[model samples]
Target: MEITDRTFPAALVALSGIEFPWDYNEKTEEPAPSNIDYEPYDEFDSAEETTDWIRSWTGNKELDGDAFRMFGQDGTGGIATLWLVRPGQPLVEQPVAFFGSEGEIGIVARSLGEFLWLLAGGVGPQEAVEFGSDSGVPHDELLAVARKYSGIEPRTPAEVLAAAREEFPSFNRTVESWCR
Candidate 1:
C-alpha cells in the first residue's frame, strides 16, 4: 500500500494495535527504559484533541494542531504525530514529528516509511530527538512491520534521523516560534 494514502493505511492501523514488548528489564531488574516509551494508540487522535494539545503545549490558544495527526505518546506524554508540512501532499508523505511534554520538538522521520525504519532501527520518537539517549531498542517485533510497510530499503537509526533532520532543518525553530 502507498504510504501517503489519504486514509490511515492498514499498516499503521495494525501498528497501533501491536502489543510491543515494553516489559520490565530482566537484566536490570527495573521497569522498561523510559526511552522506549512510545505507546501507539488504537486510532489517530481527533482534530479537536490535537488542537487542544497544541494549545496546551504552546500556551497559545490561537494556534490549532489540525496540521498534525497524533497517533502515539511517550511515557512522559510526548506526542508522536504526522506533521502535515508538505502542503497538498498525502498525509504519509509529510514528516513525522515529536512534541515532548517537556518542550522537546523535532522531526523524527521524513515520511511514514522512514518512520517504520526508525522504529525498526530501535529508536522511538523520544529517543530520536533526545540527541544521545539510548533505550536498548530494536524491538525485533517491529522489523516485519517496517519491512512490509517501508517502501525504501532498511536504514540505520542514525541515517533515518540525519535525513529527517536535514529535510526539516527548521522544525525546532518553527515549533519554538509557536511557543508562548
Candidate 2:
C-alpha cells in the first residue's frame, strides 16, 4: 500500500525524505565511525521488493513480508521498518525494527513517537544493534523533526531502546528461530 497521509503518520512521511549524514573513508569508500549509518528512502519499498527480500533473507518462500513496511536502510542494506504487529492500531503505534544484512534483528523503538526521539538521539535502527554499548550523538535536524511531530516527551536513546527490548524480549529469538 502507498504511504499516503491517511496510511502513515505525518511525521514518518516527512522523515522519509531526510538524507542522513555518512562518513566514509576516501580510499576504500567504506563506512566510518561517527556516521549516522542510515538513509531514509523517498518512499516505502514496493510490496514485491519486500517479499523478495524477506524470501531471500529467510530462505523461506512461504514467509511473506506483509507485516513489514520498509522505509529506510543502512549502508550495508540492513532494513528499517515499521513492524505491524498491533492489528488494530495505526502505523505510528507499531514497533520500529531493524533487520540487518548480517542476520541481526533488533527492536529499535516501540512506537513512532519514540522512534523520532531515537533518531534525534542519533541512533538509527541499524545502529541499534550495538544497544547500550554506544552513546548516540544528537542530530539537530532530527531533533527538530522529532519535536515537530512527537507529542510525547523526549527520552534518551537508552531509555527508548531499553523499553523496546523489555517489551519484546523474545524478538531476537523469534526472528532467529525462523532462519533456516
Candidate 3:
C-alpha cells in the first residue's frame, strides 16, 4: 500500500526496522511503479539511529527515494507513507539550497509541492502530501502546487517545470555554499 514498497524496499526496512512484503499495491489506493528494484538490506547500526535518520529525511523532497512514511499499517492506512527520495540522490550533497531562489516566492504549498513534484517525478498520494506539508512553503501555495501537480490542470506541468528550472540552480548553489 505504501509507495516506497514499489521502489525502495531497502529504505523501508532500514527505516521501519520491521520486515514485510513490499508488494501490496493492488489492494491499496496508491499504485506502485512498474520499474523497481526490490533488494535486501541489512539492519541499521541501531533502531534509534534508523528513527533519527528517517525523521531527518522527512519533508526533504530531494530525498524522496530515501524518505520514510510513518503510520500504523493497521490504524490509519492513509497516514502510513513518507518519502526519502532525496536521501541517496546526488542532489543530497546540497541539503539547504532551497532558500531564496527565483520562483521560490510562489504560494508556499505550491513551492513545496513544486519542489517535491520536481524531485520525485510521480510519487504516491501520501508521500506527496507529506512533502508539501513538510516543505514549510505555505498552506495555500501547497494546495495550489498540489492542484497543479495533482493533474488537475494542463498548465501545472509547465508551471512546475519552470519552478524547477529556477530552483534547481539555487538548490545546487545552496549545497555548494553549504559545502564550502
Task: Quantify all predictions' global Cα lDDT against the true fold.
Answer: 0.79, 0.81, 0.30
Q: Which lDDT value does model 1 have at 23?
A: 59
TM-score of each: 0.86, 0.87, 0.24
* Per-residue alpha-carbon lDDT of candidate 3 for residues 20-119, written as tens digits (9 for 90 to 100): 2233366754324321111213421233443543334343323322333232221123322222335434221111112111112111112323433332
Question: Which residue runs does candidate 3 get wrong by more than 4 Å?
Answer: 1-110, 115-158
- Model 3 earns a TM-score of 0.24
On lDDT, the candidate that comes out on top is 2
Q: Roughly what TM-score does model 1 have, to 2 decimal places?
A: 0.86
Q: Clash pairs of candidate 2?
A: none
lDDT per residue as tens, model 1, 1-180? 223333675668868867755555689764465336679987788778989999999999999877888888888799999988777777777889999988988898999889888887677887788743244467676788988877789887888888998888999998888889
Q: What order do candidates take by lDDT, descending?
A: 2, 1, 3
Q: What is the lDDT of candidate 1?
A: 0.79
Q: How accurate is candidate 3 locally (lDDT)?
A: 0.30
